[model samples]
Target: MNLSIFFEPLPEALFGGDDNPKSVGGYIAPFLHSFPDWRSAEVVLIGLPEYRGTAGASEISFQGPNLIRKELYQLMKGTGPWLVMDLGNLLPGIHLEDTYLRLKEVVEMLVDEGKFPILLGGSHDLTYGQFLGYEHLNKTVSLAIVDSQLDMQENKDAAPDQSHLHRLLLHEPNYLFSFSQLGYQAYLTPTTTLAALEKLHFELFRIGQVRQQLKEMEPVIRQADLLSFDVSAIKHQDAPGQQHANPFGLTGEEACQICWYAGQSDQLSSFGLYGYRPEFDHRALTATTLATMVWYTIEGFYQRLRNLDFQSNNFLRFSVGFHDNPNKMIFYKNRQTDKWWMQVDDLSGQRPPMVVPCSYQDYLTAVDGEVPNRWILTQARI
Candidate 1:
C-alpha cells in the first residue's frame, strides 16, 4: 500500500528546530525530507483530520494535527533508539463510512507490517475505524477507551457522536473480547448506557475511582490490544481545545500516567488520541499536554522488558492459597521493572496458564484470601 496517496506532507509552520540535533523535530526531519521505508520504521505517525461523525462539532478547522506537531517538535529527543515517520493528514472520504473504511485500511496495513501507528484524531468516533482494522487479522481484541462519557447511544441519527459505540458493540463478525472505559464522569454517562455496559460485562471506571486507584487501573489498560483516548476525558482546564470537554475529567498528569502504562504493556499493539480542536483552543495548552503525553508514552515504550520467559531468574514467582478453596493463586514479579503479573489456569485446556499483567496491590489482595476484582474480570472475559 502506498501510504503517500492517502496522506500529504505536513505544513512548514509545524516544523520546529530542524537545525538543532537535540530536538525531536531534528530527529524526525530525515523521514519528512524523503519518505522513509515503512518496513524499516518502528513507529509511524498519522493524522486523521476527520470530524464527520461528531454532532455539533462535526466539521473541524483542520488545524489540530499541525497544532500538535508544533508542540511535539519542541520536545527534546530521548536517548532510546526510535525510528519515526510522520505521514501527514489523511484525505477525508466523501461519506462518513468511506472515511472509516480508509482509516481501517491504513491501520490494518500498518499493524500487519509490524509498525505501531500513533493516530491523531479528528473526532473520537474515528476509534471505530481503528477497531475495525483489527478484524482483518482475525484476532480477538481487548480495547480500552478513555473518555468522560460513554459514546454509545441508540439514536441512529446522531451516528458519529452518540452512536459509534452502538455500532461497534452490535456489528457482526465481532472480534471484541473485552472493552473498558476509563475516566468517565458519572453524571455525563446515561443510565441505560451504564446498565448496558454492566449487562455486557464490560469494565467501566469513573473518574473519581480512577483518580484514587491508578495502580489498579494499570492492569486494565494492559489488557488492551488497542487504546483510543478522547481528549475530552481530561478536565477542560487541561484540554480546553476539545469540542466536548468536561470540567470534571482526568487531570493532565493522570492522563499521561495512563499513556505511560499503555506504552509499557507487551500486549498493546496500537494507540490513538482523538478530539482535539485547534480553533476552540485559547492558548494551545491542549497541544502541549498532548505532546507531553506522547513523550511519556515513548519513554515507557523504551522501558519495556524484552524477556517474557517466566522461568528466567529475571522474575520471582509466588503462590497464595485461600483457606476456603484448595486452588492456589500464583503471581510473578519482574525483578528488572518491579512489575507484577498473575497466572490464571486456562479452564478450556487449549492453552497454558494465562500470564496477566497485575500489580503488587492485587497480590496483597490475594494474600488476604480475597480474589482481586481484576482476576475475576479477566477470568470472565477469557
Candidate 2:
C-alpha cells in the first residue's frame, strides 16, 4: 500500500488557507499535511470507509465517512482551539486481519508523531486494528467500548455484525490494558458470554445503570487509555441509522456524555465513533446525531485538554460484574508508575481515582448496582 498517494475527498467546509489538504494512500493527504510538519497535533480525525467486517453494514456504512464529515463541518463551523485534521477512509477489499495490521501501521505513524487518532469508523471491528496499532506506541492502551451489545459471540462465523468483538478478544495485544463495556443490555448478552467476560475481568455497565448513576461512570471513562463507540449503543429510536439498532439503549444525550468523559483524559489518546447507516436513517437524523456526538465528544475532549488543572494520569481501569448480581463484583484500576503495563490490573491492584462529589451509594449504582442518570460527570473540571 503506497500510503502517500491515497486520494481522499474532504468536505469543502474543511478547506483552509492556501495549501489544500493532500490525499495519501487511501487517506486524506491534506489533513495529514495540516499539522505542524507532522511532529505535533492535538488530534487527527480519519474515516474508516471499510465496512467489510460488518456483514449487514458494509454497503450502507460506505456512506459513513462522508455523512459524519458533513455533519461535523456544520456543527463546528466556528469552533476554536480544537486542532483536528480529517484523514479520510480506510477502504474495503482488504483481508480482515490484514486490514487490522494496515490500520495499525497508519495509527502507529500518527502516534509516533504524537498525534491523537480520532477515527470515524466503518464498524466496531476496527478496534482490533486500533488496539494493534497502540501496541507499538510504548504506552498502555485501555479500551472504552460503548455499545448496546457486547459483540461477544461464541460462534466465530456468526454474522460479522454480531461477532467483530469476539475476534478482537481473541487477538489480545500486549499493550492492551482494560476493556470497559458500556451500554450493554442483559438480554443482548448471554449468561455464558457474561461469565467468560467476568472471568477475564472486563468491566460491564448497562445503559439503565448509567442512567441511574451517571456520576460514577466517569471513573471508567477517565481510566480508559482509548475510546471506541459503536452508535448502536444509542437506542434505535434515538439513532436508527445503525445496522444493529437496539431498542433498549442510551439516549442521544447519554451517548454524548460517554464521549465527553473519554475526552476529559489527556492520557486517552485514540478515539472513534462507529456504526452509522445513512440509508437506514429515515430523516438523516442518525448521521447528524452521529456527527454531533463526535463534535460534543471533541468538545468534551478539548475542554479538558485546555484546562490548566488537567493532569496526565494514564490509569487503566477494569471492572468485573456478576451476571446474576451486577453489584457483586470488583473494580480494578491499574496505574503504571514507570513502564507501559498491559494486563497489569490482573497482577497489581492499584486504586482508581476517588469520586469527589459522589458517595458510596452513588458509586455502586454508577457501577451497575443502580440505574444511571442523564448526566454522568457533573463535577468534571471541564
Candidate 3:
C-alpha cells in the first residue's frame, strides 16, 4: 500500500530548526521533502491530528500533534541505533468514518510488516480505528486501554469519543479475545456499564486498585496485542491538555511506567496515545509529560527479552495440585525477567488450554490451594 498519500509532511517550523546529535530528532527520519522508507524501521511514529471524533472540532486541536513532537524531538535519544520514522500527520478523509478507515489501513499495513506503530495525538475515539487494524490478522486479540472513565455511553447518538467502547464491544467479525481497562475511576464510571463488562468476563481495574499495586498492572499490559491510552487518564494537574481531564487520575510518572510495561511486551505491536488538545494545555507541560512517556516506551522496546519459549532454559516451570480439583495448575516463570504465566484449561473444549500472563501473587495464590481470579476469568472466557 502507498501510505504516503494518506499523510502530509510535518511543518518545517515544527522541527525547531536544529537536530542535535544527542536528541531524538537527530535519530528519527521525519517525512519532509519525501516519505521516508518505513520498511526497514522497527518502530514507526505516526501523528494523528484528526479531532472530528470529539464533541466539537477546534482549529487549535490540529496543532496538538506538532506540540507533542516539538517536545519529543528535544529529548535525548535512548540506547539504540534507533530504527524510528516519523510518518508525519495523517490526513483525515472527507468523512469521519473515512478517517477511521485510513487509520485502520495504515496500522494494519505497518503491523503486518512487523513494525510497531506509535500513534500520537488524536481524540480517544480513534482507538476504534486502532482496534480495527487487527481485523485481518486471522487471530483473536487482547486490548488494554488506560482511561479514567469507561467510554461506553448507552446513547447510540453520542459522539464517537463517548460511545466508541460501546461500538467496539458490538463490532462485527468479533476478533477481540479479551479486553482490560486500567485506571478507571469509580466515581466517573457508571455502575451499569461496569456490570456489563464484568458480565462479559472482561477485566476492569479501578484507578485506586491500580495505584495501590501498580506492578500488578504489568501482567495485564503484557497480555495485550495493542494498547490505547487516553490523556484524560492522567491527573488534570499533570496533564490538563485533554477536554476530559480530571483532578484525580494517574500521575505523570505512573503513566510513563505503564507505557514502559507496554513497550516491553513481545505480544504488543501497536500503541496509541490520544485525547491531547494543545488549546487546553498549560505551558506545554502535558506535551513534555507525553514526550517523556514516549521516551520510556522506546527505552523499554530496546530492553525486550523475547522470552516466549516456555521450554527454554530461561524459564522455570512449576505445577500446583489442588486436592479438591482434578486439574493441576501449571505456571512458568521467566528467569531473566521474573515474569509469570499460567495455563488454564479451556472448558469450551474447542481448542487447547491457553497460557496467559499472570503475576507472582497469582502463583502464590495457587500454592495456597486456591485458584487465582485471573485463572477463573480466563477459563470463563474460554
Candidate 4:
C-alpha cells in the first residue's frame, strides 16, 4: 500500500523552480511530497520511465515526465477545483516486464478508488500494464489505441513492445470486450495485420478517415474504457519526439481534439500517452504539444455532463425494422449531448443484448436498411 516505494518524486528543481503561484504546476501536489487523498481528487497523473521493449528506444525517456512537467507547469489551470496530482515516475524494475507488473498494480490501486489515472509517460508497451489494471480489478473493458501502425507481430520471439497487442488479445480472464484503434497510417500497417484485425472484429480508423470526420470520433472514444496514444501517430513536423516519426500523421490540433474527446467520455477510466523521446524533441515542441493535449483532456473531464441514460427522457429512441428480417435495430440519441447509442439483440440466450456507443452516421446507415459498422463488429465479437 506504500505507493511511494514504486515511485520517484519529481526532481526538486522541476517542482520547485518558480516562486509564481498562479500556474498549473502551482496547483499540482506531487505524491512525493504529499500523498493526495485520492477520494477528494478526480484525476491522478503518473509517469513511467521504461522503454526497454521498444525496438530502438532510449533511456532519455526516463526523463520524459520531468521534461513534460517543465511545459505543463507553465500552462494555465481552469476555474474549477484543481483535483489533479502527479505521482512522479515509477521506479524501473529489474526487467522491463517487471516494470509493467508494477505499473499494473499502481493503476489498479488508483482505479479501485475511482481515481482516473493519466499516464503521462512510458513506451507503447506500457499499456499492457494499463490493460492489466482492469484485469486485476476484475472489470471488463473496451480499449482504444492511437498509433501509426498495428503493434501485432507474429514473431514468437518479438519483444514486449512489438507484440503487446497480440499478447493482450490472448490475455486470460478474457476481460477485453472490444478494441478500437485510431490514427493508424495505412502504409505502415501491413495488409495481413489489417486482415487479421478485421477477421477478429476490431475497429481500425485510418488517419485520413479520422481527419476528415474528426468530430464523429467522439462516440468512438466514448466507447472505450482506456486509451493508449502512441506519439508516433503524429506527423514528424508536429511531434518529432517520436523515435519512429511518421511523415504523415495527425496534427497537433487533431491530437488535442482526440484527447479532449477521450476526456469527455463518461466510460473512459484510464489514459496513457506514450512514445515521446525527449532527445529527438527539438525546442521541446512535442513536450509543449503534449502539455496542451493533457490540458484539454483535463478541461473536458471537468466539463463532463454525465448524461448516459438511454431509457430515460434524456434520450429519444428510434427503431428501424425491415420486413425481411423481423428484427429491429434500436437507436437512442441523447438530448443533452446529441450523442448516440444502439441496441444489438443477443439471440443466443447466453447473454443480454448490448447497447454500445455509436454516432449519427451509424443511424443513417441503419436507416438505409444496412447493417451499421459498429453493430456488425459487436455481433462478430459476441
lDDT: which candidate is best? 3
RMSD of 4: 1.8
Could you estimate the TM-score for every candidate? 0.95, 0.73, 0.98, 0.95
Give the clashing pairs for model 3: none
Model 2 residue 15 CA deviation (Å) reads 6.8
lDDT scores in order = 0.83, 0.63, 0.91, 0.85
Which candidate would rank higher by TM-score, 1 or 2?
1
Give a tens-digit lDDT track for model 4, residues 1-382: 8777888777776686556677788788776565556567788888878888877655455688777878988988876576888878888899987888999898888888888889977788898988998886565789999998889987987877778998899998899988889998888789998988888888899999999999878888999999999998899999888887678989999999999999888889899999889989999999999988888888888867676767789999999987689888999998878888999887686888889989999999999989998888888777
lDDT of 2 at 180: 74
Off by over 4 Å in 3: none
- Writing each residue's lDDT as its tens digit, candidate 1 over 1-382 gives 7877777667665562476778777766423454557778777778888887776654568778777877887889886776777777788888888989999999999989977788988788899999999988777888999988898877657657567878888888988988999988888888888997887778999999999998889988888899999899999999899776577888999999999998888788789999888877889899999988887777677677866999999999998999998989999998888889999886677767778888899999999889987788777777
Model 2: per-residue lDDT, tens digit, 1-382? 3444333645445433233222111122235333223343466777787677777543564767777776566553324366665665564435767777778887777766767778887777787777777776675566788887788776767766578677667764555555778878888888788888766666788878888877667767766777888888888898988886678788888877777777666667788777777778887888877777777766666656332221345534334454666343322232442111111121122544332212334335545644323113221211
Residue 55, candidate 2: alpha-carbon lDDT:
76
RMSD of each: 1.8, 9.1, 1.2, 1.8
Ranking by lDDT: 3, 4, 1, 2
- Count clashing residue pairs in model 3: 0
Clash count per candidate: 1, 18, 0, 0
Off by over 4 Å in 1: 30-34, 57-59, 348-351
